[model samples]
Target: MTDIIETYLEDFGPALSGTISEHLEKSLGISAAAARKRVSRASGNIRRLGYVTFARKARFMYLENQFGSPLYWRKLVDALFSTNSAYGYAIAALIQREGFVPEWEFPIVCGAPIKQSRHLSPATIMQRLKEAGLLQTIQVNGLGDCICIVQSEEHYNSLAADTRVRLITENILLLAVKDWLRKLGIVSFDKVTIRSSTHAPKVGTFVWDLTAPSYLGCLIKTGKDKKVKPGFVAADVYLGDTITEPGSRPFINKCKTLRALRNVGPCMQIFIANRYEKEAFSLLKQNGIMPATPESLFGEDVAKGLSELTSVLHDAASHSLDPERFERLFAALGKIEGAANQLRGTLFEYIAAEVARKNYSSLVRMNQIYKNQSGKKAEADVVIITDNISVRFIECKGYSPRGIIPDTEVRRWLQHNVPVIYKAVKVHPDWQNLDIKFEFWTTGILSDEAIAMIKTAQVSTKATRYSLGFKLNQDVYDLCKSTKDKGLITAFEKHYLPPY
Candidate 1:
């Protein structure tokens, strides 16, 4: 199931929806788009079908059909054809210039690299070619032998003249290389590597991510052999015989974040962990600013930084004889730091994650329970358990005055000591308040007092300043109390409640 979903994601990033997508699965063996794409394709009205409805809810859209109807399929096919007018234009240009369409597979067989424009896919282009009936497949004995399906066509007719194909060919090659170059964030080809490959169009491109505005890659393998490696000769002055051939690339202008913060105020940082994450953190540290999530990306430092900053701000405002002075200073500092954040975009993630976590359900809502284990020691902040048909975890947050989840607690959970990270981030009034949620999940039981306790707990101003955990307002407390007292679970389908 996961594989099918991932396959869909790989094929279509966004423009996926509705029932015609289903037609593709049934007719083309491609599952996972909405049934409506076929409709959108046909009528240009995209919402005709999809799991966005109740029938397909159980199946993730990416794993579902494109659309549920056939009329929609025709629409989609027509849309694809109408959209490729540019391809036709280019082909027509080439044909006119050369005075011929060049035996259907002539260009490909004679050796030409094929890649789609940035907004399109090679597969989509191939599909268009199939629709135009202009493609002629052949059995090539070498590297680029995709799938052997020999072609036989008596006569071919194209809407445009001969010049389209030639012009399109040139454009395709240039665009493929340009897109590849963008991946490496480079603008100049002078400092590039181009090598031949055993494949039909043998050429690969590379560049630095930081050095270039965008990272694009392309390899045009044109022929078969031991003489080629789909390799390229780059003008990386420091480049050795190979791209990754240590010392072949630039010194990766990696400056630490801490170091970059030299001129800035205190700040927080989280290291997402992989090599890239570490490199990012290193860059921040190098800049001389506070990198919050240390130890691990979400380590003690995050909580500490928040706590420290909160305290510093609140303390200064509270203790100073002239509070106005501190307020003015703080406001000025906030502007300066906000500007830095605008430039970096890292600090916003913490706040964004909090917002997203609340609005996002699914795997994210599972944050309600986190799991961990302990062999010989007790864990702090959480607990875990499992049974025949269910698994449950409890997280206890110690949101005292400076209210924030400690990194030690995160480490504890990673060590199987704590149950989850969110619970630890919340500043609930009573520990027992949440204990009942765990009981409800595991035993299918809920205690009125426990329900009331959690529901009644109010959000602390301190905790709100940090993590965006739900505030357990009065309405929730009452709702839980009423639900528990009425034994709504027992009522099941017959249950009904007043619109409080």
Candidate 2:
């Protein structure tokens, strides 16, 4: 009976109407009217047995038995609901090729685009899944517009724990890199771009995660002819609290990733978040991997110089009208010996702050770190508090050669950082009532798509409370050009201001 039903369905495809009866009659050597009765009986039996479903109104057959389990159905739903047909097929193929596990661990599987025909947004995909009894979505605050999908309530709790650990560990890795760069006199928060493969464009890019043969680091170097030469660096960032066992599956996967990265380049470093992960360190060392803590990245003199430089900047922020202190700080930064690019980033932040202080009524604070009630912290590059109690939270990005900021970076700031700022404002007693605004101040050209996304995000419920502004390359140049200080203007033009 199952074979006959399967054969009939296979001949006519998932949806059957007159074609099923016509094919059955020809194949079974039966009269057309008799074959029609058999078709009805077979469909009824299949539906009663709960192996397949027949939609009466739609007159379509759906093979529910093809999906072995709810997990399998979930995978099919993910593929069917992808952004476009091609992208959907690609995701489905990837799942098939990679063998979907309960804990898939791929970033693309969670946040990839949904089919346009369904008119579903990423935020609403889980609701549709829940209606189908495939998955449930759980809202998690402070995680910034995230969705958690699970097969069951018990699975949701287990996955949520894993997700939180992953997020915290990733955040630690980002903060650690920023701290290391700051200690080395690199101050621009946008110098390093952290992106997952799921967010990358579809063409010529492979999915990358903590356990992938991804382009972990690509540092651009100026050749002898002054042309740009890109160099790849292999680095593994691991937080001890997240991955405790040196012999665990995750650790093994990371080792495999590192091996693949090493095949492409010889220069590699292992960055451990906790110094007490001695077993992990030993494992790396045994495998000939060089491990370094953030503190050990710089010399004592360089560390001391950075400390003094921080003090000078703080003094300038506090005493913006003090020309002598400003000059001294600028001169010290110029004289400090290090990577030119790193110094350029540091100079960009300071000049941005200086420009803001000169133009605004007063600098309430610059480079201040704020934490929300949920304990999510964000550092604002510059904050201007007007006489009317209006506050501006500015984000500065220094991308040299212009027009290099990708759409992913713009989306990251909007979807993630904007919420952080919103929450920070909500929790602060003094700033809660003030008219707040956000400005993306960059020395790089903004793409039209990025600008549009920003405009849309500004009015979105996630950021509707604050007004949005943009300060692009041209704006920065104009702001710097207005200053009468020739030396300061020249320095700004050379480092922070982009050419026309």
Candidate 3:
């Protein structure tokens, strides 16, 4: 595995070296020889272990498998800039700290301090940490950040007694449910929000509310002006696997927590691993609560995607030392990740092809970037032609986890370039007289404001005789799952979905 990854990195070494040298000269005023020496060491470390070994004696037996994959290693290397080994050492010390309490702040799991000086800035270091996936930024009432070191499911499950870790797990499950709901055509569904118990009791730990408006009864005196209420739905997710038996202190406390949540009108959900399912369910049932697996909440299609993702990860980790296995696993990862839109373009292409398979004969062309006679350049992510001579053009955007597709970007694309692109395609002699349709696809949640802008844009575009439509993260996932491909279904059942 190390050899395979080394070969992969060899293709990028010159680029990496150039980046490191420039950062060192600009950030630290380092000499060229010193920078080259540092780069050499970093490169050697990556080639040997696929990650930096910060601690001289500390062992990472549990994390060995994670280092097997080139992607994970690339993330680590990318996290460290030239002459920033101190930041790496600081992270290592934090990981080594005993009885670590997770916190949502810079220097999240503090142990040995990374000295603050003119040469090293916390802001830049923190940003690098986030880019490396060693940290994650989240929004609650305000922006907050937290450590995100566990790269795989196996590593996450190995942690003990960390409420924050448990919360992260629960949030992932909730996100899956939110995605599933979206796929089911619930466009009004809002993204789930995570709130700490310390902040607000009414909000619970996780909340999902729809934004559609509802009419309420009119005021008593006038009985004319009707009150308006916003649509809302909430769920309180409890990680209950740690409870050993019923009637115990922890079990009772959890029940009390659920009772409190019920008083606040949100449904209660408990997630337990299979090992503790019988006992956990018995205790919850006695309290009028039923425990649910992640699969049961999100359904089979989601389970399959989740399973395929993890299986690829686990396979890469388990075979990190074998070149043959590494190559095979790398190829598999590419296919899964490609279909999953790791490269951003694949997600759009996959959706376009799938839609064509269902309705059109086949995809005509993908990733067509063109300039009109007016010199306006516009790129369509995908293009397809149906048997009836209908032509479809798609634009795709892939956003990271917890990211939002903003209204401003969508507005610019819809108002400025889309019209010109339509004109350019219409002028093509071969495409003349063909009906044209436009679609926008994104793997991120679209804000209500953005959706409103899209709708308004759709109205204007329709006036020009072009049809326009949009699909967000949930829509894409639902469409893929509905295909019911046998291999995907098996992967989901065997790997992704929780064992019932």
Each candidate structure's TM-score, on Cα atoms with residue i matched to residue i, is 0.15, 0.38, 0.31
Task: Single out the weakest 10-residue window by summed lDDT for candidate 2.
Answer: 203-212
Per residue, candidate 1 scores C-alpha lDDT tens digits across 1-500 of 33433354335532333333564567556545543433233322122222121233321232223432232233332332244322332232223222122223222321112332242223343455445433333322111112111133211222121222222222222223334454444434444322112122212211211121212234223344523212222211110011121111011111121113233222121111112234534543564423332123223433233233333333322221222432333333323222222211111112122222233211221112221232132222112222222222333331211223344533343333222333442333333223222211111122355444334432322332222222222222233344442322222111112224
Clashing pairs in 2: 81-115, 82-114, 82-115
Ranking by TM-score: 2, 3, 1
Candidate 3 global CA lDDT score: 0.44
Off by more than 4 A, model 3: 1-348, 487-500
Ranking by lDDT: 2, 3, 1
**Top candidate, metric TM-score:** 2
Residue 147 displacement (Å), model 2: 32
lDDT of each: 0.27, 0.48, 0.44
What are the per-residue Cα lDDT tens digits for candidate 3 across 420-490? 77878778887767788888877666789888887886776654478888987667555546765543323
Please give the lDDT score for candidate 2: 0.48
Candidate 3 worst ten-residue window by lDDT: 207-216
Q: Which regions in candidate 2 have their CA more than 4 angstroms from the true location?
A: 1-338, 401-403, 459-464, 498-500
- lDDT per residue (tens digit) for residues 83-167 in model 2: 2322222223223212222222233233233333333333353444445443333332212223333334444443333343343
